[model samples]
Target: MIKKLSKKLSVSLSKSLDGNNEDVEIWTYGLELLLNGTIKFGLIAGLSAILGTFKPTFLILITFAAFRCFGGGVHFSTYPRCLTFGVIKFLILGSISNVKGNMFNYNLLFYVTLFLGILTIIKWVPGDTEIKPIKNKEDRKKQKVKTTIVLILWIIIVQILIRLNSFKYILPITLGALTSFIFITPLGYWFITSIDNILDKTKVKYGEVK
Candidate 1:
């Protein structure tokens, strides 16, 4: 449904703007992202309201998305699978923040996440796609620098939150950063590919991947 809508909108807009085939493709991709983001985050916000995890969910979403923008991550083949699984994953992380108590040194966990995040950014950032590969070395370096800046800002934010006696906020940021970092790693690609294959089989069996 979203795919069709995006195509229709893209076609209409392209015609209105006297755009060619390339414009249509670009518009389609952009519209799909906008529509998918709206629907996915709308569902997440609604669920968070019911579960009383709005802040945590919002934090996780923001941090994950920031990292994802600069550090390209693996995407599911279909939007439906991405939306479904993405919501579940974020909701679970947000809900986990609700459980009170220190679980084995959050400071240690934060530093460890920071260390791994920096390493991942240096090694495999701009983990580009076939559609939008970062072919230029300069572009790849810029993306890595941007990702490192975001990681640093996230670390500072989490640390400040801790100092302000707002401990609950730390978990979601850490989880979000860690999860996004995984997507840039070889292991993360393997993990996502495995999940994608599983979902593909399931969709074939169920006839749901339109």
Candidate 2:
């Protein structure tokens, strides 16, 4: 049963990556990915919803922006971006909670954090042999600047949310921010490694790297 499920999921993911479906169809596929059985994704989504509960529209926009900036390929796909953002957001929120002496609601935070950490370790343990070295210094620098600016903007937004006494909505907003940070941090590294692996495998299979 587990094998069958895994195979099914793998096929779905591959199809989504292949971009064979219509735009709307592809978007639905991405949504399925985000909504699938993943604790990290759930926590991030839940937290985002909760934080933006008072202002759901803004919360959604924030979530979308975080996913687009931190997680790659946000234009037509959403699932992967959401999952990536969720894991990253949770990690950041968890860290902030620890530092600020705030007793966070542990039920979701703890489990998601643990799950992501474990997955990261497993993914990296074989030594990230798949990561492609960055060859373009200018592109790398541009990316760095863009990332830094986005992060700064996120921080400012969070502060504004807090000032507005969005305390009741803190969980979701914090989760969103944390998820964004995670995407740029460890989760981001994992994503890069995964992409490199895919590209390398494709090259080997097709006799050329695109």
- Model 1, stretches more than 4 Å misplaced? 203-210
Alpha carbon deviation, residue 48, candidate 2 (Å): 10
Q: Go through the candidates in order and give each one's C-alpha lDDT.
A: 0.87, 0.47
Q: Write one digit per residue (lDDT tens) for candidate 1, span 1-210.
A: 888999999999988999999999989999999999999999999999899999999998998999999999888777787889899999998998787767466877787888889889888898877667888999999999999899889978987998897888888888899889988888888987899888788889998762
What is candidate 2's CA lDDT for residue 71? 31
Query: TM-score of the candidate numbered 2?
Result: 0.36
TM-score of candidate 1 versus the correct structure, residues matched by position: 0.91
- lDDT computed for candidate 2: 0.47
Best by TM-score: 1
Compute each candidate's TM-score over C-alphas: 0.91, 0.36
lDDT of 2 at 159: 60
For model 2, residues 1-210, the per-residue Cα lDDT tens digits are 333454466567657777443644545545554546355545655664565432432453465355344233211022354356445544444444333223355335534633543442233221211223334556555545554555456556656766785554555554554444344445565675576567668879988654
